[model samples]
Target: MAADMAREVKLWNDKREREMYDNFADLFAIIRTMEKLEKAYVRDVISSKDYEPECTKLIAQFKTLTTSLKDTVPSVERFMETYKMDCPAAVNRLLVSGIPATVEHRASSSDVGTAAAVAECVQHFITSMDSLKLNMLAVDQLYPALSDLLSALNRVPQLPPDFEGKVKGREWISRLRNMGASEELTEQQARQLLFDLDSSYNAFINSLPKSA
Candidate 1:
């Protein structure tokens, strides 16, 4: 009599299937990490300085991954339920709210003007970055995004007059103004503008009052 053999198991049968499974795994990891980050922030185990960047990155990644997985993973909540994931906090933070807890707290706080300004600044920063990523390089397109960011920055009285975001935004707006509206940013210009925007965004987030 032959000994019984154990069957080998595979989660995916083809290259496409493997890729989908990998994406699903990445999605799970992002949600789980977000849950941990949310808990740590609530407990004050991590400072806002450390928390915001990580939360922002995770939220971005989650959005990108979910968009890619839209066909296969029609619903994130369904996927979570299928996986038996118990992460209400992560669900709220990543899905329902789609913003960092610190930002939500700030928006809810009594300082409505500053809170609203900060939120506007954050939205403009994200919009500018997304536009660049999508190659929306026309001077007209880029100028408005930067202009909005600068306007939002100006609304925040807490930021100094010499803030880096303000200076870089003004410089970029000036450069764009001289160009024809239909003219597009060169690859180099786009890259530099993205870098400046990212730097300014970080500075803006860091300059936020911890209590806010």
Candidate 2:
């Protein structure tokens, strides 16, 4: 009976380890995504308005995940004390990962004035795109802002020399130009174009230089 209990406890401890590992992995992914956002914000690839809110949201999620991990630690500690077991492999692995340090370092590095301004502009543009009401007035408002964003993105010095070619050598811009001049698109087509533009904009954002 003692041997059976030990085996059962071992199984439970292993299960908990795996669960912890999974949560750690999820938190790591979120951290990486936040890193991407920070890099874009720093390099003027995104706007502050967009970056601040998005960063806040991700940080909240990160906090919640960490809290969950913290709450589990006491239980794991009790299990260790009761069973005379060392730390589980998952927790040990997490300690080795050093995720907290990584997240803090990445976020701190991106705090710059110019980047903050650009990040704000990117956010405003995104907001403007989202605010379109499918009416003629909205369409008219969107065209100039869309053109300006495209122009600004193209001018960002951090973009690689061949960036345009990689994104089909300004074909996306041409699509925008055509739409801008013609203004013949029905409401549905206009909305779809805005969606496409957003996709293109994000693709550009992701293409900017990644942090080392």
Maximum-TM-score candidate: 1
User: On residues 101-206, what C-alpha lDDT tens digit does candidate 1 reach at each position?
Assistant: 7777775657867866776678678778867875778987778778978998999998888999999999999999999999999999999999999999999989
| lDDT tens readout by residue for model 2, 101-174 | 23333455653433443343354345334434323223344555555555555555566556542253245446
Error of 2 at 59 (Å): 19
**RMSD values, in order shown:** 6.2, 15.7
Q: Which stretches of candidate 1 lie over 4 Å from their true place?
A: 1-8, 108-212
Per-residue lDDT of 70 in model 2? 67
Candidate 2 wrongly placed segments (more than 4 Å):
1-51, 54-117, 133-139, 161-184, 208-212
In the predicted model 1, the residue pairs found to clash are none
Error of 1 at 156 (Å): 8.9
- Lowest summed lDDT across 10 adjacent residues in model 1 is found at 1-10
Q: Could you tell me how far off, in angstroms, the CA of residue 107 lies in candidate 2 after the best superposition?
A: 16
Using lDDT as the measure, which candidate wins?
A: 1
